[model samples]
Target: MKLLDPYSLVLMASMMCGVMSAVLFLVRRSFPADIQGLGHWCAALAVQVLATACYSFKGTLPDGFVLPVANLLFVLGNGLCAIGLQAFYGRAQGWRMLGGALGFALVGMVYWLFVVPSYTARVTWMALPLTVINGTQLWLVLRHGRRHFATYFLAMLVGVNALLVAVRGALALVMPAPTVDLTQPGALQGAYLVITAMVPILLSVGFIMVATKRLQFTLERRSASDPLTGALNRRGFDAAYTRELARLRRRPRTLALLAIDLDHFKAVNDAHGHGVGDKVLVRTASLVGAALRESDYLARFGGEEFIVLLPDTDIELAATVAQRIQAALRTACDSGIPVCTASIGIAAQTDPRQRLDDLLEEADQALYRAKANGRDRIELAEQEKRRASA
Candidate 1:
């Protein structure tokens, strides 16, 4: 009985906005605090709360102002949301943002001046564009891997609202029937009661799911990552390496493995204390990560040692990569450290008979030789040398 009220639905929508605000706050903590996209989300949620509250107080507003004000606020909230989506996805570039903004402005002006005066006019045209813009944004989210949970949440919102609009549209066509009562809280009133009952349930459930996903990601990162370096810890590294090895088995291809050990690392830890050594480690990791392509994998194997996996790279190319990593680490600056160098051992999947574990052991043996012969140089696997000689 209580579910038939429109104001109840408006209150539920406002509650959803409150939940969204909490999600934005939690997500912001995991990322860099000064991110611009987070600010846009906060602004958009504020507008949505205001719009929903306006609808909740519709009976109290003056006659001419109610419809115009509520719909206008909806337009503002959705428009700002579109802009925020563009920015958050990093697609608000060049002519695309300009074009989207122009379209929003044009439709907003026309709706305000021409459509708001007559209720029928608003239903016939305004609802279609609203559905299209929201649906398009959901499609964009599915296309990009980032913010996929956000996209899915928004898709449910769009679909539910589109269904509401369609049902209302069908009722408008049969309004002249004697059985219809446009003001009643029933299906005869264009199923307003049905939408009012269902929309709040959908919105509330969807908001809860989105907030849960955001919180889960935040929790997983804190538990699985290194606090000082933002790199994967031992647990994370093992999981990633195992997954990569399985994937490599499925698609047979050339793979290069490099085992890197910091030269004279104990001297620094002894001379300057562990703090300086940690700084040097972080700086070295940053340099190596920057030098490699995004597809390449790097992980801290243990104290003062690292491992890198380069897919589709042969031994020759792996040597070149090892050299780049060495040169980059040499030039890398760490606070209160003079200079740092690394000795790297290079190995690759050259033989069809070699397994991932075999490749790793060969890389480890070559790393020992690199440390044995000198402090800072690349050592190739002996089998690789024999292949080249032949």
Candidate 2:
């Protein structure tokens, strides 16, 4: 446990950080949709680890071999952090902007390493660019991460690290010249070295938390939605239908259900194949969505059948929606692989005492009638019979 000195300590810490970042990178790849730009975050940490390793070689290696590469990767690593966080918030870092900054850092490193070869000059050059990258990250988190505490902590870490770099750069201008040798104790040198050695682990932890949360959210959403058309799946539909029924009980409002079936969908699959039929299902969902309003719900009830809930809608309005959806499907398939149409059966209930199963059964019966009357038509449930019974 002699891991106390600046050089040895940094070497160990950087190695561990590199491993953690690499592992997290692999995990993020498993859910690429949820954690966008995580690959960049992983790359940044890996580069930072290498840069720290180069610092360990300070006097042992030639400046030409170590200085420029280390500083270049250091700056690039910080830049990638900014880029990755920007992606998390749906903001993108333009390549032109990134390339320009990266190029400038490289040019500066070459000038200092070859021409001046001063440690102070290299520190000043590396510090300023790192500050800008960190500052940009601070702005992104503040602007978009207000709701997430993980993001707030991330911003704070970046902010402090940026300030430390700025302070080190300023001290280099005033303090006497210091060599890359770690044996001699200098205040600014020891402080910044310790920080660079340590911050990556904390930063990695914070970013991983952010990524984990995003992955969880995405998984939850996927569970609720159909993979093909993005409509609510049967399980999700049942939950929603239950909620709508509860609402009807709390208040005296009309609730309508539309039981919809795709006409000749089996034939579409048989003639055009399942691939084309899937496209038709997706298109059918889109068309149904277009016909519905904000207070409506659409679910893939089962194969080739869908259920729609129209809140505060009566039989007439529901019938109109059903007709519009049928027409929309007909038009949508006019030029596609095969002609497609829909049969919709609607049922409405204004009484708070009515049961959900009763409503669904009425709608299903009406759907049967529409099929009996020939496909691609709308049918309404027998409200009069229920009214007479009540």
Candidate 3:
């Protein structure tokens, strides 16, 4: 096949990438939780767009413009990708920032040295850093390769990068003699356009799809989680509790529920306006969540009230858990709420005959007693039962 002829396969890839970029942009707007990550992805797509443009205008654009534009795009895109990867792994700050800055500086040096000289030197200088970034991205995916979509996307990226490198080599080998035209290449003008255009497009499509889905997932999570406290909202809490109850009935696990109401919570809300009250709620939720085991779940039941679900925890252990929670909340301090305390009503399932409603009823009764007993106390349903029996 003549290297000058356009490859249909490459053209298809370019179209796909453009469509995917649009789709990813729309999807990114939907995710507030993953906004930073989505921004990084958007940056990556911008690079892909630049790459596509470079491929299209290769011979037409001045050598000065072409090499600097193309190489710089790749560098920026790769840098954004690294940042996005770090964000995904929750390690984007500190040393990673230092590393990213160093990488960008090196990329700028390469652009000045190679792209300013000639296309051939530009391609040569571009190879190592491009490979390093692509390889590092692939390694990250491989390390977390169990995710089906991530693996697929990473594979696609690797394939596209390899194609780019191959095209660069072909471009170098097939160019006309120095006397004829330093600007225009003879052998693979058409082929170069096709490959360069198509590769970024195809890779962009895969990346956009991945980024879009991730954005959607992040949106769903944000919908379910309380923004201030990181606990499940009323709807989320109900859904979770219902699911746990249903699961427990099938498997018959020892389950407990603690209904925690902050004493004088309304006073806090009234005294400091809603903002300070929100902070207190957030702090209290954090304290309570920290007190829980990984297996346990804590959620905001409603304003000033929270619910905790403990699987495989008996009545005694549940009371102990409640006491620990009480202590933690009492000690919590941020922006000054004075001394805060929670009145927790704890109930556990001892009999397989009991239902979730029954458990809740028992716990509620215990809570009423705790409030009646003054405030700032943990009262166990089993303890109430003992007193009633006596």
**How well does each candidate superpose onto the true structure, as a TM-score?**
0.67, 0.75, 0.72
TM-score of 1: 0.67
Worst 10 residues of 2 by lDDT: 179-188
Per candidate, the number of residue pairs that clash is: 0, 0, 0
Pairs in clash, predicted candidate 1? none
Candidate 2 TM-score, true structure as reference: 0.75
The candidate that wins on lDDT is: 2
Residues 173-265, candidate 2, lDDT per residue (tens digit)?
777565333445555456666776677777877777777777776787789889999999978777877788788788888888999998889
Ranking by TM-score: 2, 3, 1
Query: Which residue runs does candidate 3 get wrong by more than 4 Å?
Result: 1-34, 39-43, 46-69, 84-125, 139-199, 226-228, 246-250, 270-274, 350-353, 382-390
Better of 1 and 3 by lDDT: 3
Instruction: Report the Cα lDDT for candidate 3.
Output: 0.68
Error of 2 at 234 (Å): 1.2
